[model samples]
Target: MRLLLVTLVCLVGLAPALASDLLIVTEEFPPYNYQEDGKAKGMSVEVVEAVLDEIGEEAEFVFYPWARSYLTAQNRKNTLIFSIGRIPEREDLFDWVGVIAPFNTSFYKLASNGAIEIGTLDDAKHYSVGVSVKDVIYQYLKGQNFTNLKVVGEDILNIRKLAHGRLDLIAFDEASFAHRVAQEELEPLLFRQVYRLEDLSGDLYMAFNKDSDPDLVERFRSGLRTIKENGRYDEILMRYQLMN
Candidate 1:
């Protein structure tokens, strides 16, 4: 009886460590994941939290700069990155689940500038364009030998540069750029989305480390599907004014 009791105690001690924990990485991209009122609140955060809740797991979110966050997700164990675009080069780097949102890459110009008519990527070849550094859209443009492109460290800077005439055009995710414009009161700058790159339509997903247990990834995926079906996911998105 004492031997059995000792064995039971050993099992109990091991149970908590055996339970899965999710490590999440995010950046300060508003309407997705950002801090407000001393809390991590956004459409992606709420949606990810709901999924974890449904799966009987908890998450620990580590906020970092965009580049650092991407690298952390790439190198760390049990870590997942949110709102990452599904790109061809990054397709196999991690286990993917939950295409949390879809956004379009667009070319924006000042409202008063009607002279610059950008109907396609090739049309803007002559003018200087700004995009976020290490962004998928920027990489795509670079690969096409688009010579007049500049990289900004952050998305907000790209918008500001365009507003200030430092750049002729800016390429960014539509939702993110719109949110920044609204928040920064840049409406007078005349933002026009000239071309929506269909190939660059970003499918945002929760990507876990490749070495992560497949069962855990599937659990999260199942939970995400459930939330989508039950309308919880949509409601969360609506709360953030993200869903159209």
Candidate 2:
């Protein structure tokens, strides 16, 4: 009887650890995952939490700067990064799941700046453009040898630089840019969507580390699918006003 009792205790003690473990890395980018009042709260956080709950999985998220988050995703075992742009160069680095949102990579110019007419990448070559440092967009532009491009450390500064006439153009995700503009009430910084680069349409996904357990990935995929099928996915998107 004592042996049976000991066995039961061991099983109970190990049950929690046996649950699927997920480590999430994120950055403070609004409308996605960001810190609010000292707590992590945003669309991506809520959606991921819901999915984990559905799968009966355990998850812990660490928010860092964009560069740090990206590095963490690349190096950490059993980890995932949220709302990462699905780029070809990064295709084989990690397992992908649940495309959360699609972003239009557009060029924004000052409303009064009539000299700039961006129909293609070449059209904006003469003007200095600002992009977020270490972002995929910056890498893409740099690869193309686009001259006169400036990279800022943070996304907010790109818009500010554009507003101050320090940058002739700015390349960024349209939804995120709009969210920042409205939230910050930057009405004077008139930005126009000059060129929509379909080639750079960013599809956001949850990227799991290459060394993560396959079962955990499968569970997350299943949970995501379940949420989408049951309309919880749409609800979460709507909750953040991301979906109309």
Candidate 3:
């Protein structure tokens, strides 16, 4: 009984360390989350940093391609990923921290293409659609049996392809599309959203690996809740002009 008690105490003491040290990872999904000047910066980054400040913690953030970040967050322990979709297929894969940003995906076509009129998701199927491989949009569309999907290594590439008329359409985040369009110095009239994927309209979330310390996850969750209630969340969003 004494040995059991000592072992229990030791395990309890180890829990905080198991969770406190985290490696935060994400892809270059701008406006929401991205790296600039070799440092993490964006709407979601500000939110995460605010939460950390509230919780009195710090962690290193690493940005990589979507697939690498996704796999690293999945295969490694004590990993947290942000601005990622909370899709059904990924439901049980991680310990979800909390929703961090708004995410709405839609099928976009060049405004110049007056010849294309998609009245339904099925109608858009006839055109070649660009999607980043392993991205939430790609996964969702592929699962929906979209046969014309043109997989790319990154969503930014999809933007360039669509701009060049290389793709008939592209699955893209609504807000990110506007941001990227402006970033590429392209006119907003160049493209328009033809179809909104209601199924993919869920907000993005921050999540720790399935095996991460639950206590640590709860701390971040609580910090997020506190910020939302205290107005810090809204302040950050307003600063970014992302309040919607």
Candidate 4:
């Protein structure tokens, strides 16, 4: 009878970790998480899949707008959102699995527009700065009280605006910006890096809802550690050509 009772308790304790019904949400952020050929593919997606496989779990991935995905992940239980910034404001909202990748953000300006010179963030604040709405870079600058700011819904819109002289400057992760420029056939040489926001630039992480099972989060962390230790993490980065 005692053995039966102990077995029940142990099973109850292991339920969370052994169960694998994780719902993963992401946005259409290229090279990280995006739809390719009617299927989900990207560096972040592959990383998440590898970690889940390592932990002997499966996740259902769905893409939505960044705002909708963020809200859904916040309110739903046992939900996960990836490639999200581990920013100060959102630190207490979710259980952080770990950093999946680094997102090096920087301010940029057109090289032809030599009229502006930005040595500091403050110097660039006077000009109209374009940023994707609800982006970490936008949130950071807004928190810093940047006055002349232009918020757009789409990230590529900012690049287009910057190219057309609608925005004096724009901010985005270096990889994303380069991809957008290449996709739009915009001259990469036209835009020059003004200032890299090292302090504000944060790593991308998978954040689980507050009500998520702690054991499940720990499983993901353990899997991530395994990949890093075995050098599979670096292999994924190289596969995406994200190494710098």
* Highest lDDT model number: 3
Residue 29, candidate 4: C-alpha displacement in angstroms: 1.8
Candidate 2 has its poorest 10 consecutive residues by lDDT at: 1-10
The root-mean-square deviation over C-alpha atoms between each candidate and the true structure, in angstroms, is: 9.0, 8.7, 8.9, 9.1
Model 3, span 9-118: residue lDDT tens: 12111122334367787777889887666667789988888888888877767666777778777877788888899888899999999988877889999999998888
Off by over 4 Å in 2: 1-21
lDDT of 4 by residue, 59-177 (tens): 66777667666777787788889889977878898899987876788999999998888887788888999987776788889888898889887788889999999999998888888
Q: Mind giving the per-residue lDDT tens digits that candidate 1 earns over 60-140?
A: 566665766777677766777887888777888888886887677888888778789976778988789898777677877
| lDDT (Cα atoms) of all candidates against the true structure | 0.75, 0.76, 0.82, 0.80
* Highest TM-score scorer: 3
Which segments of model 4 are wrong by more than 4 Å? Answer: 1-21
| Between candidates 2 and 4, the TM-score winner | 4
Query: What does candidate 2's lDDT look like per residue over 1-244, in tens digits?
Result: 0100001112111112223355677776787877765566678777787787887766556666676667767776688888788777778988897787656788899999999998778887889999876677887788778978897778898898888899999998887888888877898458788988777785678878888889888888898899889999898887776773
